[model samples]
Structures are given as C-alpha cells and as structure tokens.
Target: MWPASMPGSILHTAEVPAFDPRTGQLSLASHDLISAPLSLADVFPPEYTLLFDPSPSRPYGTSTSAADADQPAGQSRRKRRRLARPDETASPLDWIRHREKEATRSSTDKESDEHHAAIEAELGTAVEAVRAGWMGKGEDAWMGESKGRYEWREKEDEDVKEELDLVGLGERFAPALDEPPEPLLLSESRSTVSAAALFHRIVRNDGSSCISLDIEVDASEATPTSKATVILPPSSGFLLSQLATWPASAPSIASLGGEKGGWDVLIVDPPWPNASATRSSSYDTFDPYDLWKLDLPTMLGDSPTLVAFWLTNRVKFRRLLKDKLFPAWRIQQSAEWYWIKIASETGEPVWPLDAKHRRCYEGVLLGYYVPLGTKVDLPTLPQNKVFLSTPIGHSRKPFILDLLRPYLLPRDRPPNVLELFARMTLQGSFRRSATDEDGEGDQQKPGIFLAVGNEAIKFNIVDGSAAAGSVRGWLRRQEDTERVCAAEEAV
Candidate 1:
C-alpha cells in the first residue's frame, strides 16, 4: 500500500512520512542505515585447511623427530589432543560417569575420622562416595545416587528460573501503544517496480522495441560443509540466442557498454571482463570479474547517491574504469585511494615490494556529480589514510563500512548502511553476501579467536625459545607438527 501522506515523486527517502494505522501517528523509516552482526561464519564456512609459510622474521625451530619436537627444549608444550569420534550407543554423560567411577575406585584418602566426616558431609552423596572410592562398593553406589538426584533437581530449577526471567524482559520491552508502524518487506514482497519500468527509463533512443532473450539458470544446493554455486533466476519463454538478436528488454553484452547514470554518490567495481585459458593462471593474470558480466546501465538504474567503485592497477582494467566505465556510469571523478597490498613474506613495513614477491594495493575510485534537484549530505573525504595490513585472498574486497566512513549519515546514533554482494563480515550493517565466509571450521578455536586490527598490529612474544624469533610463527609451525603426531596417534 502506498503511504497515505507520501508525495508520489519521492518514495525512497525517509523524509516522506508514513502513517501508523494502529496508533494514527506519522513516522519515518530510512532504508540507508542497516544493522548487521559482525561475524564471518554467518556467510562462509571453512571447507579445507590451507598452509602458508610464516614470515621469516618470526621463526619456529622445525624438528625431524616427533618426540623431541613435541617437548622442545625448555618449553613444556601440551600436545594438541585429537578428539576421538563419539560413540553412537551411549550418551556423552555416560562416559563422564564411567571416568568418574574409575577415578573414585583408584583414589586414596589419607585423613583422620574428623576430616573424613567433614569431606563426606561437604562432598554430598555421589561425590562423597566417589571421593571415598576407598570405601565399600555399596556405600559408593548409595552416595552417587543421592548426589546425582540433587544435581538434576538443581539444574531443573535453574532452567525454570531462566525462562521466567526471559518472559519478564519480553514484557518490559514490549512496544508502546503510540509506536510507529513497522515497515513492510518491500524488497521481498509488495514490490511495485519491475524490469519493464527500468527498461523504459533507459532505452529512450529509438522506439522500435527489441525482442528479449531468455537465459536459463540452475542453483546448486550446498552440502553441510561445502561452498555452493548460485543459479540466476531461470529465463522466461523470451528466447534470443545471439547477442545481436537480444531484445530491448535484454541488451547485448557488447551494448552493455557503459551509459553512465546521474548519481549523487556512486560505488562501482566493474568486472573488467578478461578471458583465461586455465583456472590456476586466472588468479594472477585474469580479471577477477572475468566471469560475471554486468550491464552498467542496468546496475545504475537511476541511483542518485555518492558513487565509489573498487579497481585494480592492471593497465587495461585501470584504463577501462578511468576512461570507459566511469563515463558510461556518468560519475564525476573526485578522489582515489591506493590500497597497499602487503604479504607477510615481504617482512615488517607493509608496503609495495617486488624483490621478494610482486605486491600491489587496490585503487578505490570515488566519484560524484551534483544531482539537478536532489538534496543530499555531501560526504567529506578523509585526508588521512587507513592501512589494513592483513593478507586477504585474491579479490577479497575491503570492508566498505570501514572505507566509506566519511560518506555516512551525520547522526549521533549508528547510521544505516547496506552492502550489495558483500562477503567480509561487518558490524551493524545490512548485508547480502553473494559468497559469504562464516569463519567456520577448525579455525574457530574454543577459547581464542583469530585476532585482527590493533591487537594484531601490536606484537606480543608468548613464552617460547628466544632462538625462535616469533611466538606466533612458532605456533603455526607447531600446528603442522602436531597434525602429524595426531595422525600417528590415530594409527
């Protein structure tokens, strides 16, 4: 339903008021600010482990012998314990019970009758019997039952209390009678706009409507522990095989040639379509977007906002964005940032290095053009640069949330930001990951997480050999040796 008080001309902005039917109050819902939880595992899961050499500065002594390496020199390192596969027949608690019983049987109590009485009274039923494993079997069994029953009762009561507390919190935070109306899910449902509206808005040159071509797509289902390929929506009956035969609805890949839009802010990362003969060679030589062909006109679709597009330093790709892509998108160039890519192998100062390894940073293209009639808060560009030194995989885009801070809403409260085809995790931003990495798998350690940011920048030497220059490097090498020991143990 169209908002009762909305002006038909501007439906996208929050400046337009929406009325609540329940309370009869006017309110605003801005789509700009999004709330996304900061987590990697939500989008991507680890499928397999990849090993890379640690930086030379930090070195761990590698050993040939397992026994010597496991207990290296002065440091007493606990061997990485490999967990056994669970038993299907019995519950885990049963195994705990078995261990406890065995421990009780073997344990010795060296105490007077007064101490023994205190221990028995304090330990309670099962624990007391377990402690008195030196005692008779009947006594142990009787005490175990008593302790077990008490524990169960206590746990049940705690659960009941927690449930009641949650109910109370729910009541306290309930919406007031005069609250504004919740937003309808326009993206998923109640969408009035269609491809036809977009097509009419762009194709204004000649009135002869072209035939639309149909393309079939098949979405693949991901396994519990695997990455999945996405299938685009299947083609309708509209069929045109060759690019030349493409109808008005579907422009040819060639004609997808840039026709820029008039936008206040623009963010684009054109996939400089580059072909490759082999898959392995593609990462270093081929354009990252070689496979994903995008239509510039279709992508812009009359968006009037600040525009920024990610680009590489590749001569052809750089030239395409500067000369063709930017012009086609109708974005006025404003600023550029060099993302100095550094590998750990290049050593300390994270900068461009060619002697050890060819390293380069990404070039972020920022551009904007004043809208003829649009009112927007022009963002102030940052003079100071930010350096994110972590080694990311190829084509792993920088966090827009981190980079586009200058172009944010000037509000005390958190601003709403939306990400399209985003993969890396962000805090408090609405996200739609085309290929998400949830930071799952063996990397998600129980007590420690993979540290990044300031903490990562500040080096700390863990208790280890001085001969081994860096502790982190040592730990990583130890991880491999531990893996071998685990394999042998399994055998």
Candidate 2:
C-alpha cells in the first residue's frame, strides 16, 4: 500500500525574487539563473523535494465583483488583475479570458444532477489538497507572476500550432516534395554529453529568440542489468513512419494479451477534440478512438500493469474513457486523481476552480489491466486524490513518476514506462541532474522511458535567450522550481 501519512510539501522549489511584468522583459534579478546544465529531476524534482486559498472547485459564484473584491490589488492593474475578470479598461486579452471563463462556469452549472454529486465531491477534494499544500501561498514569487504568465508562451506558437497527426499517417511514403525532408536526428543520450556539460544550456537575459531546434534529449541512467532506450523524433516523414511501425518493431508486441516482453506501465494523454486552445491548441484534434489502432493490449508487460489516462473537464470525454475506451482495452476501472494548477504568486488557482472558461484542475483515471497474472505488484492509488503545482506552460505536466516511484516494480525488474501523446520528453533533458541535489530517495535504475507523440520532442529542447554565443535554448521554467526547461501539451 502507498504511504498513509502525508508530508507538508511534496516537492522542493527554488524561491527567487519575482519579476514585474509591467515592464517588458525577463530581467536577470527576477530570473533564477542556472549555474549548470539541468537533468529531468533538476528541472522538476519528481517528489520529495518540491499554494492557494481558492473556492471549492465546483463553481463558487459568477459575480465578477465578488471575484476581484477579495484578490489583492496592485499598481499595474492590467498585469495584477485575476484572469476571467472583465472591465471597461480591459484589453483584448482580458475579454478573451472573460468569455472563456463565462462559458465554462455556465456549462458546469447546468450539469445533470446525476453526475453533479460525483464531480462536486472530487473537485472539493482537490481544493482541500491544494490549500493544505500551499501553506499560505509563499510570498517570494509574487512579483514574478507577470513573467510566469508568459514564461514559455513563445510568439512562434502562432505559426505551426496545429499538429499533423503522426498516428494516422496512412500514405504511400511520399516525402516532402519542395526540399527533400532531411530528417534531423539529434541525440542527447547517457553516453555523450552528461548533464554537467550540456550542449543545450539555459540563460534568461533580455535578448532570447524562441527557436525550436530539433534536439533529441535522452534522459536515462546506467544501471547494471537494464539499459534505458529513448525514442525521439526524426522531425520529418521518417518520424511518422517510425511511429506507425512501433508495434511491429518490438517482438514483445506479438501477444497483446499474453505477458511476453510488454510494458509495466502505460500512460495516455490523447488529443481530445475541444474548443479551447489551453492544450488542444497545438494538436490537430482528431477521433480519439483512433488510439485503438496501436493495439494497446500487445504492450502490457505482466498481469495488472498500471495504466493512467489523462482527461479534460468535459463530461463526454470522461464518459468515453469510463465506458468505451477502458472496456475495449480490458482495463478494470480504478481510482481517479486530479491535478490543480495554482498561481505562483497568489497561491490560488491560475483560473477559478470551476471557472466558466476553464477549470484550473484536470483529472487522471488510474486502472489495472488484469491479464494472465492473478495480482498487481504496485500499491493502490488513493481515490479522488488531488495534488498541486504552479502552472508552467500551456501543455507541460509535472513528473508523476516521483509520486508513483515507490509503488512501481523494484529497480532490478526495471518496469518499462510508455507514454502516448507525450508532447514533451518524459525524462526531460538527457543532461546530468546534479547528484548532490537529488540525494533524497533511492534512484531509479536503467528503465525504458519511451515517450511517443508527433511532437514528442517538441518541448524537449533547452530554452533560454542568447548572449554572445552562450547556449541558445533552455527550458523556460518548471512547475514549482526556480529552474526552467522546455516541456509540453497535455491535461
């Protein structure tokens, strides 16, 4: 069983002075400079290392006045004003936020009573969990809220925001006509370039251009028995073809039901068709059920392998998983968990808990696929449990591996980890996370952390502004830590 007692803070974060967004750019003082290269754990301390007094996520009230009346006032009205609040002086950005909020709130209010009770109970659980963890929404990052708001929200997202589905690319192997698609294969693996001497270093001075260089970051460590394998993008037709043949590539996929050489844990973050751009903005929304084409059962390791599915707040999507998707995959329904996105400065939900536009919290449905084995080796996850983290970017998610580590198969067995629609790298950068800083828990052995998606390497590059020939890209910012990194789209 998982631990019963809860700690005060689940993850450790670096506290830095807040940068005032009223002014145009990210200045040096406000930024927490990384003296060295970062590893996956350094960017987002999985657990042991790493806010808010918000309403009970299930829609408090729609009074705009009541919303801002309690929020702290500041000098820069535009930057400090809470999101979803509308006013005469508000700009285009404000109105966009307002409309989205209103739509969400209205819909949630009209939910059928049959489902309302369960939604209400789960949401209330998230609110309490966040409030307990926030511990007064620590005051240090208050000024930096402005920078955090647009941290990795680069101007380039407008250009190719729509995703070209790799899963359903059924063509006659026709390559790009204009200029032969020269797939760039960049590898940041355990062998070359340890985290200490990184090719992708980060710096946050005034002059940084947001460029997505095709970099394959392989975040793996060398244990005696098993060696970790990272599958990254080739950035062209090759990538699509490569992913299409994933099932055939592994002989283990031969038997979807019988436990041969299959994965121990499987995570799915499908691009559900929805109106909002929150995460779906970048991906070309398509029939989510298309995922069955991959033949999931062929990938299960042993009996009762863990499977976690991320879903939006939409009831239809939730029902699809509980009803259609799970049954087809033969996965037994289990626990549901929620992740609450809180403001770094205010220690409140980035958006209202049950805002009309978007809810600050999303859910994860956990289940076990019982195959040939009689029992699951992993411990049980709590039902309707909630965890909190500062919002990073439109798509980035915190490393849940840390929370689930203890419950996973022991290091020697080295469970195969697989993630679908992983817009960002699971292990993050292939750089060295400082050993001294990550000395808390026992480290994971050389296990496969395969992150599969069209934009799998989309958020894997190091992001930062350029100086006279310093490292070009560096991850912008992490969920709670002062350090930053490139991450991506999901619930």
Candidate of highest TM-score: 2
Measured with C-alpha atoms, the lDDT of residue 48 in candidate 2 is 14
Q: Model-by-model lDDT, in order?
A: 0.28, 0.44
**Estimated TM-score per prediction?**
0.33, 0.54
lDDT of 2: 0.44
Estimate, for each residue in 1-491, the C-alpha lDDT of model 2 and write its tens digit: 11111111144322223233446554332101110111132332122111111222222332346655776555335554444366777778778876776677655344522344456654554455445544554453321232232233344543432322222232323233322232223433223322212111111111111122332223334211111122222111112222344454233332322322345677777777767654444455657666657666666644456788888777766777888777877777466777766654444666664454457777788887766545655565545555566545455565565444444544344355566766554332111134424544233332344555555544443433332212222233345324333233221
Error of 2 at 422 (Å): 1.2
Q: Write the per-residue lDDT of candidate 1 for residues 92-185, one digit (tens) a residue.
A: 7656765665456422221222333432322222222222332343322221222111111122222222111111222233333332122111
Clash number for every model? 36, 31
